[model samples]
Target: MIDYGSEIAITGDDPMMDFRADPDLIEFIEKLGRARNHYLSLTRGDFTLLYENEGMAVYTRSYKNETAFIALNNTSEKQEILIPTDKLGSKKQLIGLVNNDLIKEQNGNYPLSINGEESEIYIVRDNHGLKMLNVIVIIAIPIVFLILYFYIWKRGKNNG
Candidate 1:
């Protein structure tokens, strides 16, 4: 219900509502809420079915050059599937934004095993988060120096 900006309404009628009394359930809900609210692409993104089979299906939601890869296992048993990624632009890794799972593309495909009926969402991107941080620092240094230089120049001009 999050995709396309649909409101997710939870009432007392849900089958899982019985767990409302459990702290574990509340914790899980909190985590899910964080996952849903923290990611803008998950709420408003272009949806595409990447792969599908009788036992499982894989899809993606993308926005602003970012994409979330979602996988669902429909059967009660563990199912393994290879998601072809040759067509997904330059994405080489899928880091779980909430699940803490890390997946790397292999031979232009991603192999995943889902346990029972479960769903996983991964942010499709290169494992360059740390690199990006370094890049940010690198880019900021010159800009900061330029700003300081201009400020000092202006102050010196006013004083003179």
Candidate 2:
């Protein structure tokens, strides 16, 4: 959490003006917003605390055909953790939603490294679902076009 002094009021008209003056605070707020949105919007409301040790904690949430894993490090040093794929169910890939990084399952486990006082969120999804969705979209687009084309052609013929 970005700590703003009690003297500084973050609310009112132009609330972000003070926040914008500090570049580090701005970046921290942006990252926090991204992480919050990724967890709240994409994942199911329920979450499980997968692991917690010392100054680090790991949480996981599942939504639809995907699962989200979030790791937070509270210490001043970087931390690494190994998570088994079986704990995340039947997932084929772990894609970082916040940082746009991809981690493939290796030897039945995923190794993650998080910076000090930083949080990372990853989405676990099956490649087959993505491929099938793409195929459905590709076929649906042409069918939609054909339907529109026929409707327009019939309308023009009747008008003529």
* Top candidate when judged by TM-score against the true structure: 1
- Give model 1's clash tally: 0
TM-score of candidate 1 relative to the true fold: 0.64
* Candidate 2 lDDT tens digits, 1-160: 4455423435667735563355665565676677666555343556788889999999887765556778889999999888887787554677776567677776787788888987777777664545778889999999999999999999999999
- Which regions of candidate 2 deviate over 4 angstroms? 1-19, 23-28, 31-44, 128-160
Candidate 1: 10-residue stretch with minimal lDDT:
1-10
Model 2 vs truth, CA RMSD: 7.3
Cα distance off (Å), candidate 1, residue 41 = 1.3
Candidate 2 clashes between residue pairs 3 or more apart in a chain or in different chains: none
Model 2 residue 91 lDDT score: 48
When summed lDDT is taken over every stretch of 10 residues in candidate 2, the lowest stretch is 1-10
What is candidate 1's lDDT per residue for 118-144, written digit by digit as tens? 778788786444577888999999999
